[model samples]
Target chain A: MKIFIDPPNSLILFDLVERFGHEPLSVMATIQERVDNLEIDMPPMNVTLTDVKNGLKYAGIEVPSGIRGRLAVWGPLIDQAEAAIIMEDAPYSFGCVGCHRTNLLVDFLVRKRKLPTIEIDYPRTEEDARNMVIRVKEFLEGLK
Target chain B: MVRETRLVVISPLSEITPDQITRKVHSLGYEVTVKETCYGAVLEGPPETVSKVMQELRALDPLGIYSKIRGFPLGDPKRCRAQHGSRPGFSQLQTEWQSLSLVEKGLECALRGDKAEDIDIPERIPVKDLQRFCEEVE
Candidate 1:
C-alpha cells in the first residue's frame, strides 16, 4: 500500500531505512511527482514523499487541476489519497506542527472524505525520530 | 476562591502528539492547565502545581515552547469589567461575528435547501469591519 509520509527531518529518514528494514524509495516534493511516478511502482509497495512545493515550479509541470499554493491552500489535493502519515514538522520555517489551516482540510478529507490518516508527533530529538520510524515500520509490518 | 483549572496546551497548534505536552508537565509533577490563550490568563492552583508549572516552563526553550496560556486569576468573586471610560473590550466579538455569519449561512442554506458544508466561510475575517457591521445591525 502506497503511503504519503509528510516530510520528517533528514535524520528520521535515515533511521527509517537503516533500522526499520524498509526501502526508502524517494522523497516526495510534490503531489504531481507522485502521480507521474505511481505507475513505475506497482501497488502493495509503499512509496513515501514529503510535501515540498518544488515540483509545482518546474517549467512544464502543469499544476494539478483544482490545487495550488502551500499544501494548506490545496485542500482538494488530499481528497483522493488512500492513506496519509502527517508529520509534525519537517521545516520549521512553516508552523512547527502540521499546518493548522491544512489540518481542518485533513480532518475534512479524513472524516467527510473518508481518507485514512495517522498524525505523527513531532520528534523531540534525533533519537526519538529514529524510534518513531522504527515504530511506524513495525506497525506497518503488522498490517502485512 | 474559585480555582479555575486551565489546560493551556501550547503546541504549534498543528499535528501535536497525544499527551506530549501533558507528559512534559507531568514529568515535573504539575497538573495540566487547560486554556488556549497564551498571555491572557493568570493561573490558579495548589502551590506545588503552580511551582512545578513555572519550573517546567522555565525548562522549555522560549522559542520552541509554542505555549497556550489558559488560566483565571484566583481572587474574590467579582466581575472584572473595564472602567467606564476605558476602551471597549470586544473579548467575545470574534465569536459573536462567527456565530452571526454561521446563522446567515444557515438561513441561506435553509432557503435554498443546500447542505451547510457546501458553503465556505472565509477564515480570515476583518474584525474591525465586523465590529462596525455588528453595530450597524444592532
Candidate 2:
C-alpha cells in the first residue's frame, strides 16, 4: 500500500513505512523530485492570480492562496494514497504541515479523501510508544 | 533575511526532567519562547540558532527532541493574529501539543528501533552514539 505519512518530512516515519514494506509519501521526497526533475516552472493548481488579488475577501467562499498553494502540493499525495498515517501536533517537523494554516487544510483534505486512515498523536511515554507501534503495525497489516 | 520560527519538542523517554531540560536549552543564546506542555517544551526560534541549541539538548536526552519547522517566521503579523489570520489561535497550542504528543510517542516507537540495549541502535536513530555524541558536542 502507498502510505501517506503526515509531517511529510519525517524521515523516521519515512523509514518506518519502508521498513513495513510500503511506500511512504513524504514532503522531503516530493520536494526532492521537483528540484531534481526541474518541475518548478508550473503554477500551483489551488490558487490563481484572481484569488491572490481578492485575498480572503469572500470569507467562506474563498481562502488565502498561501493555504491553497500548499494544498496543491500535498493534496495530490493524499489522493494517491491507499492508506494514511497522520500525526497531529507535529508543528515541529520539517514540513509545511507544521504551519497551523496548512495543518488544518491538510486535515480537511485527508477527511475529504476518505482513505483508510489512522491518526495518531505524537507519543511521549513508553506506553504511548508501545501503542503507537502496535497501532501502526496493525494499520499496515490491515492493508494486506 | 526573514527569521524562520521552529517548533521543537523535547521528551525524554527515561526519567529525566523536562523542566530541567528546558532550563538547560534556555541558557543557550537563542531568543525563543519556551512553552512546556505534556509532550515537552515547544521552543520557537530562528532555524540556525535553534539547530545549535538542539545539539546541546539532544546530548542531554537524545531521543527526546523532535522538531517541525513552521511556515511563518517568528512573530509574523499573519501568524500572530487570530482576528484576521487563518493561523491557529493560542488556545490551539494546548490542542496542538496534545496532538503532537502522539507524534512524539510515535516517533520514539518508530525511531527507537527494536533493541534499546544496543548502543548502535541509538547511533542509527538521531542520537547517534549517545555518550560519545554528547561528549563531542560538549
Candidate 3:
C-alpha cells in the first residue's frame, strides 16, 4: 500500500510505514527525482516551471505560490495514497517546515480523500508515545 | 569529507542490549563516536565509517536493528535536548523509539510466514456528526 504521510517529509512516519511493509509516499522521493535530473533545477531548489503550472491544478491563481508549489508536490501523493497517517500539532521542525498554508491545505486534502486514515496527535508523554505506536500499528495492520 | 550522524534503534525483542551494542560498535575500531541511548545508540563519524558500522550492527539482528541518518550530529548543543530545554524533533524521535518494539514484532511475524490479521481500530466520526458536535459546542 502506498501511504501518504502529512508533513510529507517526516522521517519517523516514513520509516515506520516502510518498516511495517508498506510504501511511504514522501516528498523526499519527489525531490530526489528532481534533484537527480540534471535538466531540472539544482539541489535546494528543484522546482521546475512545470511544477508551478501543476500547482494551478490544486489551487487558484490568487493563492500564494508557496501553497500552490507545495500542493503541486503533495497533491499527487494524496491522490496516489491508499491510506494516510497524519500527525497533528507536530513542531515546525518535525517535517515540512515551509508554508503553514500549504500544511493546512495538505491536511484538508488528505482528510477529504476519506481513505483509511489515522490522525494522531504528536506524543508528548511516554504513554502517549506507546499508544501512538499501537494505534499506528493497528491501523496499518488493519489495512488490506 | 562531511561527517555523518546516525541513530541506530534496536528492537526490544532483540537479544543484544544497548550496552552490548555500544561495546560492539566500539570494538569495530571505526573513527565513530558511540553513544548508547535508551532505544539503542547514536553513531557519529565519517559517512563511510557510520555506514560500515551500521551494516555490522544490523547484521547482529537483521530484523531487530534499524538505523536512520539523523539531521543533527551528536552533541550539537543548539539542537541537543540535554543542552536546550527541548530539541525541536526530540519528541518525534521519542515516539519513534517507543514504536520500535512493535515494528520488531511485525518483522518477526513476517519472518515466521504468518499472515497479517485485521486488528480493531477506532472508526472515524462521520462528517455530519462532527458538524453537529461543532454546532452544539457553539
Using lDDT, rank the candidates from best to worst: 3, 2, 1
For all predictions, the C-alpha RMSD in Å is 21.0, 16.7, 7.9
Candidate whose DockQ is highest: 3
**Cα distance off (Å), candidate 1, residue A28:** 4.0
Report the C-alpha displacement of residue A45, candidate 1, in angstroms. Answer: 28
Give lDDT: candidate 2, residue A115.
87
Which pairs clash in model 3?
A: none
| TM-scores for all predictions | 0.28, 0.46, 0.59
Q: Estimate how well candidate 3 is docked, as a DockQ score.
A: 0.11
Please name the candidate that would achieve the greatest lDDT relative to the true structure. 3
Using TM-score as the measure, what is the rank order of every candidate, best first?
3, 2, 1
Q: Candidate 3 — which residues are off by over 4 angstroms?
A: B1-138
Q: lDDT per model, in order? A: 0.36, 0.57, 0.72
Model 2 complex DockQ against the native: 0.07
Per-candidate interface C-alpha RMSD? 23.3, 8.1, 6.7
Screening candidate 1 with a backbone cut-off below 3 angstroms (N, C-alpha, C), the clashing residue pairs are A1-A44, A28-A49, B6-B33, B6-B34, B7-B33, B7-B34, B7-B35, B8-B33, B8-B35, B10-B68
**Tens-digit per-residue lDDT, B7-85, candidate 3:** 7877666788899889998898889899999888988888778878877997898877876556455775546567666
